[model samples]
Structure formats: C-alpha cells, structure tokens
Target chain A: MLAEMIKFEISRLLKRRTLLFWGIVLLIALFTGIIEYLGMGTPKRTVFDAFSFSTSSIMPLLLAPMAGFFTGGALVEDSRSGLLSLIFSKGVSAFEYVTSKAVTSALSQMCFIGITLVVFFVALLPFFPMGSIYIGAQHYSEAFAYNEPVAYCFLIALLFITAAVAFNGIALLTSVWVKNTFVVMAAPTLLYMGLIYVMSMDATKVSLIDPYANLALIDVYIPVSILHMVCYWAVIALITHVLAIAAFSFKKDYM
Target chain B: MNEVLQVKSLTKRVKQKVILQDVNLSVSEGEILGLIGPNGAGKTTLLKIVSGVVRASSGSVWFDKSAGIGIVPEQAALLGDMDALQNLRMLSSIRGKIGTSEIKQTLKRVGLDPDNKKAVRNYSLGMKQRLMLAQAIMEHPKLLLLDEPTNALDPLGIIDLRMLLSELAQAGTGIIIASHLLNEIERMCDRVAIISGGKILRQVNLRSTEQTPIEVTVSTAYDWDILKRWAESVHVELQKLTPNKGLPRGILKTKMAVSQVISELQSAGIAIESISHVGPNLEAVFLEYAQLEGGVYR
Candidate 1:
C-alpha cells in the first residue's frame, strides 16, 4: 500500500504544475548566464565559479520557498478535498500515506533541484571557462571545489538539494496544523529568515551557524565544517518529517 | 435478520470538548438507519467513526472483518484534477477488483458521462456530488455509510440516489445515513436515531414497528369538546396545534390506524372539516428532542 501510495503521489506530482519547478530552474540558470555575460563576478571565472555563485545567490533565500511551492501544501489540499479520508477508507494507513507524501515531496524536490543544478552548470560551460575553483583566490572560495572541480560542483549542488528538502519538509509540517495554502508555502522561508536574523544577533556563534552560509556552502566570517553543516540541515529535515508523520498518524479525527 | 453492524458506548472527545457520548446503535442486514441531527450535533462525527475515518475515544464497533465497506463523506472526496473515469480508475486500482468496463458503467449509473474529458475541478457541485456517490456504491460494499448524501444534488440527482440506495438496500446492503434532510430520512430509513449534544436522544422506528404513534391533524366544525371526547374515549391524547382564531384545529396522537380514527370521529357525530394522518414526521421528532433538553430523551 505504501508503494502504491508513493506511485500515485508521484503520478499526481508529474501533473502539469510541476513544470513550474523546471521553469524556475531554467530561469535561475538564464539569470546566471545574463549576470556572467555582464561580468558581475571575478573576470575569467570557471563553470564551477558561476554555478557556485548561482547557488549562493539564489539557493539560500529564494530556492527554499520555490521548494515549498513544489510540494508543501499538497497534504492540506488533499485533506480539504476529503481525499485523505477517502484514501483511508480504501485501507491505506495514515502513516503509510504521510510517509509517501514525505518521501515523494523530499525526493522529488531533491531530484529536480539536483538535476537542474547540474544542467545549470553545464549550460554555463560555454559562457564561462572550465578552469578550476583553485584560481578564484577569494576569501570565501570553496576549498572542496579546489581539487576536483566537478566533484566540488556536485557536492555543493547536493548541499543545496538537501537544504531544499529540509525547507520542503518544514512546509509540509506547518500544513498539518495550518490549512491555508499561502501560509504553508511561506512558513519555511519565514522560519529560515527569522532564525538567521535571530542567530545573526549572536556575535560569537553567528559566524559558525548562519543558515544561508551553511546552505550555500559559503561561510561569512568563519567557515563551518562541511560535514557539520550538512548534518545540521539533515537533522532539521529528519525532525520535520518525523513530526509530520506523527501528527498525521495519531490525528483523532480525519474530518 | 442478522445484525450486520453494532456500535456500543461510542464516545469521542477533542481536548475538553465532547463530540459524542455513549451513542449505541445497530443495523440489521438490509436495514437503512438514519442518523438525524442539527449542526454541531455530532452527526458527521458519528458517521466518521462508523466509517473508520475518525476514531472513538472509547467504544467498539462490531462488524465482520471481511465485509467490504463504502462511505460517502459530507464533502466530495475526489481527485479534482482527473475526470470521473480517471478518479474511479485510480481508486479501483487500489483493490484491483474492478475493471474499466465496470468503472464506465458505474459512472453511467451516477448520470456522469464516462467519456467526458472535462476535469472534475470544473464540475458543478451537483456533478461532484454524483461522482462521490458513484465511488461509494461502485464496489457494492456490504455496509454503506453516507454523510449528507444529498448535498448539492439536483432534484433529478436526488431521485436517482433514492432509487440507487433503495436498490442497494434491496440487495442486502446495510446502510447508515447521517443527514439533515428529515423528509428523505422518513421516506427511506427503517429507523432514525436522533442525536443532539453529542448523545443519542432516541431511536424511533419509521417502519415495521406498528406501535409507533401517528399524528393526525384535525379541523372540526363542531366545538373542540367533541373531538376531545372522542380522543379521550379512544384513550388518545388531543392537543390544539393552532390558536382557535381560525377553524379550530387539533392533533390526535394515537397508535390506532388513520382509518380507525376517521371512523371513530364520524361515529362521534363530530363534523370533520378536514383531517389527515401526518404519518411519522422525523422532522417533528427531531425538533422535539432538540428543543426539550430535559425529558426521557435526556
């Protein structure tokens, strides 16, 4: 039943609106190309430089909400349509259904963001040179990107994808308590920005845990370790998914 | 007939608010039990509990584990992005027992065009309601639970539903319906359980229980005394419904047949201007239990 549920949820996601996700990816890539053409960043930058710039500029701020738009309020819509009760009547447990929603929402966002990030990098290849991240010589340059340029691009893209998944989970979690469509989409972004604002006021620890810095893999004053930063967002994602599943599974009344 | 379903001491509470309390009811095979109540009366909650969509805080619902169950929620539960066929197809795929032909036939039965390409989102409320009914009845479950089944339905759609439900009952489907439409309930149900304030006030039989009292409306040309005497002789109660400003009218509450009451009134030499048995009006009974908080109902 869980497999069937995932299969059905995936099919529903593949419906027309998901094109909007790919549209955002392409739009981000095109904006990067335009900025590079205008020579905004360091001159003679590589595809790795441009892609990293794209993630830093957009992935931390705008991309999380874009992830919200992709899959956030879906459970609410299903509940409003009375589809959850209908599906429950068909013998699908609440746990299974919510798990499928979490899996589909997270993986779909991750896959879509991951693939589109790579495509954005490939699309930047012709415009920018294929030099290494080692030549950037900037204060915030990713040393992980210095040795193997492709691996660096892939790892940074994976980090951004993980961030998307976490924000998407947050959106899904909020929707369980709040039914409004707009709130569900906007909640994660607000939380991200709000937490960043609160953390920024802490002068000592702020440098080590800036959410935007962690997500884009670029530190502001001091670089947080890559493994610790990755684990931070990963834990947030796991907690959100767990809360969403528990709330839905133990819900007293589905109506 | 064997009992197909039994609910015992069912209660549901959310936080400090109680939604249902010690509500006990049952349905025999082929029986249609109507659950009638006003808003906030826990009609939908009780139906949800029976349908297994809502859990009771404390109680038990007994039924055969293998019997297929179908439910029509108060709101249409459908994939609005898909057309009717596609919605049914997706649902049917879960059980893997239904085929395309049956899906099409079910759609046709509900008066929706099986080939219509229009998405369900664009459908009118009546159409969506019809589709909801279609999905519930498609698998022919032995136990059918319907909540506000006639909502947003056109007259024709309602007539279709009446026929369909009656047919399903005839085929031995045990049904429990929660609706505000008392006339429909009186017309269809074998018994009605009146619920209010999260409790079952009374379960009145609409059919098969001959002892159910009949309310006869009467207007007599003679003084009200004549009718009162006749009512007293027959051991029936007489109460004036309207003020004596118009032609005097009174209601005779009696377990006797309408024919017998009519004959008795004639023999009493009472000039009967007009009189008729109102039969059993579930609406009046629902109001009676709803308005009077203290009584046998309490």
Candidate 2:
C-alpha cells in the first residue's frame, strides 16, 4: 500500500508546474552568486554578508513557500480531482489514504531538497576563483591562500533545508484539512507569519516553536538550542497531522 | 429476500442545509435497485455516504451481511496518473483480492485495453467509465454501487453497460445505481426507489406485470366532454381536462383504455389528430415522489 501510495504521489507531483517555478528561483540564486564573486575585492564582512543575506532570506521566503504549497497540493490533488471517492468506495480506509499521501509527499520533498543542495554548491563554485584572484591582485601572496568555512556553510544550508521541509510538512497538513484552494495556500503562510509576529513580540516560551528562530540559532552554531527548537517544530507538525486526519475523517464536504 | 444493503434513517446536513433526511432503503441479493431523483434531490450525496467518502449524520450501512462495504461513486474514481491496470491493482491490493490474472480478464470483459500504458488523464470520458466498471467488477463485490455509469456513454456504450448490469445481477451481485436516465432504469431495473427532498417518496417494482392504466390524450379540435362523461358513466374512471404548465396543452388522467375510448370518441364525430400514452414513464413517478415543483430539484 505504501508503495502504491508513493507511486501515485510522485506521479501527481510530476504533473505540478513547480519545476518551472523553482527553475526561475534557481536562476536568481545563480545571479546573486555571480555578483558576489565579481565584488570579492570588498572587505570580508561585506563579501560574506552579501551571500549570507541572500541565501538566508531570499531562498527561504520565495522558494520555501512554493515547495510547501507543492508538497501540500500533492496530497490533496486526489480529493480535488474527485478520485478520493472512488478509492474510498473500493474499501480503502481513510487512514491508509491519508498516510499514503503524507508519506509520499514528504519523501518527494526530501528528494527535491537533495537536488536543491546540488544547485547551491554549483552556484557558489565561481566565488572560489574570484576571491583568490582578488587576493593575488592585492600583492599579498599569503592572502591568496584559499580556505573556506565549507563544513559550517554546508551544515547551515542543510539545517535550513531540513527546517524548510519540516515546515512544508506542516503546510501540507493545512492542504489536507481544507478543501478550498485559497485556504490551502493561505493557511501555512498565516501560521508561519503568525509565529513570526509572536516571536517579534516576546522571546520567552513560544520562541522555541518558531522555525526561523531555530534557523537563526543554527547559523550562530548553537547546536543544542537548535536541536531543542527542531523538537518543538516536530511536535507541532505531528499535532497538525493528527488534526488534518481528524478533519478528513469527519469532513462533510465532498471535493 | 437476502438483504445485501440495509439503511435506517440515514441523515446528513451540510452547514444546516439538510442534504439527506430519513433516507431508508435496501437492496437484496440478485437485484438491481435504481435510485432516481432530481439534481439536488441528494442522489450524489447519498451515494457518497454509502461509498464511505462522506460520513452520514446519523445512519449505518451494512453490506454482504458484514460490517464492511464497497462503493463506486458517481464520478470516475480511478488514479488519474496510472493506467487502467494499475488502478485495478491498487484497488485489489487494498482489499487483498487474489489473482491479477482474473482482474486482467475482467478488464477485457469491459473492452478496456488494460495493457495500454496511457494514464487515466489521457483517457476519454467513455473509456474512463469503462475502467470504473472494470474495477468494480474485478473485486467480485457482494454489493456494487454505481453513480451515473452511463452519463458519457454513447449508444453502444449504453447498450454494453445495460448488458453488463444484467449479467452482474445474474451472478447474484446486488447493485444499486443512482442515475437520472429513467429509460435505462425502466428497461433494466428490477425495482426502483424514488428520492426527493432528502426523502424516499416511493418504491416501485418494475419487473411486476401489473401496471396502472394510463390516461390517453386525444389531440383534436372537437369537444371531448361527452366522451369523458360517457367513459365515466360506465365506471371506467375518468377526469375532466386541467391545464398543466409543464405539459403546455391540457391533460387528464383516467383508467380508460386508449383503443376502446378512441373508438367511442370516433363515434361522436371526433377526428383524433394524435394519441399519446402519458402516465409517468418512471420519470413522472420520480417527479411525483420527489415532489419536484418547477425545476430538476425542488
């Protein structure tokens, strides 16, 4: 059953126009990487900040939400297309149906994250030569020595990807719960924005659940604190999934 | 009669709209129960509830003398990404039905190219309907529920489906179909239940030879009041003309035979321009049961 569910989920995702949308975002990321390479003569703070700021904010804001909506839409597509009734009628339980969709979509997004990581590395490759050339031009041979915070940079990127995918899973819960297209798209954004607003107000208890706070903590190398935040997001995602199932089981509306 | 499906006061209200109200009906083994109603008479909603896609407000459905049930909703419900064969495999895998070979043969029976690797999205509406039929039969279900199985079907497709339903009934598989096509029900159903306003208006058995006498309409410029009274005077059962907005021209319902009454009207120097047998050919029975006032659904 899991295999069948995954097969259908992957096929559904393939139908989505998300690939083209993501392709555009990737071009922007590439353009930023090239611009940072050309401006390598600037101070180290400005150079690092240029790439860091773009990767931290732009990728998460624009690409993260699209991925979330796509992940969520994959699960709810059957209901939207009127196929749920057919499968349910044929003795397939709601539990199996929902489980298949969630697992398949999550797995697909995991694969997508892996591909995005490849693109991330390729975009940053050009900066390596540009930085070395700038050091040589300054007539300091020792400064030309290339040493990158490769492990730290890669680790932070992985962390952001994990949180983004986890947040996408929660967004998917909204899609499964609500039948309306507008609600499915808006629900996750609203939740993320609401959490951001609450965190801006106070940083005591609820700050632990905010994925952005967790992401920021990852960048600062607070591994223990980041783990704590991931746990909270995982718990919230589990709870949201349960609620999604409940809404589906008792849902009176037919898609 | 071996009861295959039993429902008691199945009710559902969506946002207090009250889609289904006290809908009670049953189908026995080896029977074709036709469900006919207006557009919003809760036909689709009722089918969804039975199929387990929608939960009823307060009702229970028992199938095959067991606690479980299987449903085939009105719209084609196969996986759009998969071909017909894959769709059948998924359905059978859920039920743990053995033998994919038998499933393949059933697909052949329905005239679907199961080996054709085209996805369901690429299939035409008629082909998809055939696949739906194939999937429903593959499980050898104890109770089969089909909604609008003939909606997109052409002439041959309709004939093929009617023959298939007849064959399934012969195999002792109880079937309930929700459809608006009264002619198909009249020709194929053993019995029918008419639902209107979320209620079951009447249950009529079509296989029975007994039929209520129809009131014949004689379209002629001559006066037929004397003929109407003459038929009534002999206790033949008749009524005077009343204008019906639905039918346009004036009409009446009576137990008088068309041949005998037409001969009587000819003797009265009435030249009959046209004669039509118009006493509710399943459609009217549905309208009366649903109490459809103006449009498709009241």
Report residue A151 deviation for candidate 1 (angstroms): 0.8
After aligning candidate 2 to the native by TM-score, how far in Å is the CA of B262 from where it should be? 6.6
- List DockQ, one per candidate, in order: 0.58, 0.34
Q: Any residue pairs clashing in model 1, and if so which?
A: none
Q: Per-model TM-score of chain A alone? A: 0.87, 0.71
Chain A of model 1 scored by TM-score: 0.87
Worst 10 residues of 2 chain B by lDDT: B242-251
Cα lDDT of model 1 by residue, B37-73, tens digit: 8788898888778767789999998876456578898
List TM-scores for all candidates, in order: 0.88, 0.78
Chain A of model 2, TM-score against the native? Answer: 0.71
Please report, as a residue range, the 10-residue window in candidate 2 chain A with the lowest summed lDDT.
Answer: A133-142
In candidate 1, residue A215 scores what lDDT? 40
Q: Tell me, what's the RMSD of every candidate?
A: 3.7, 6.1
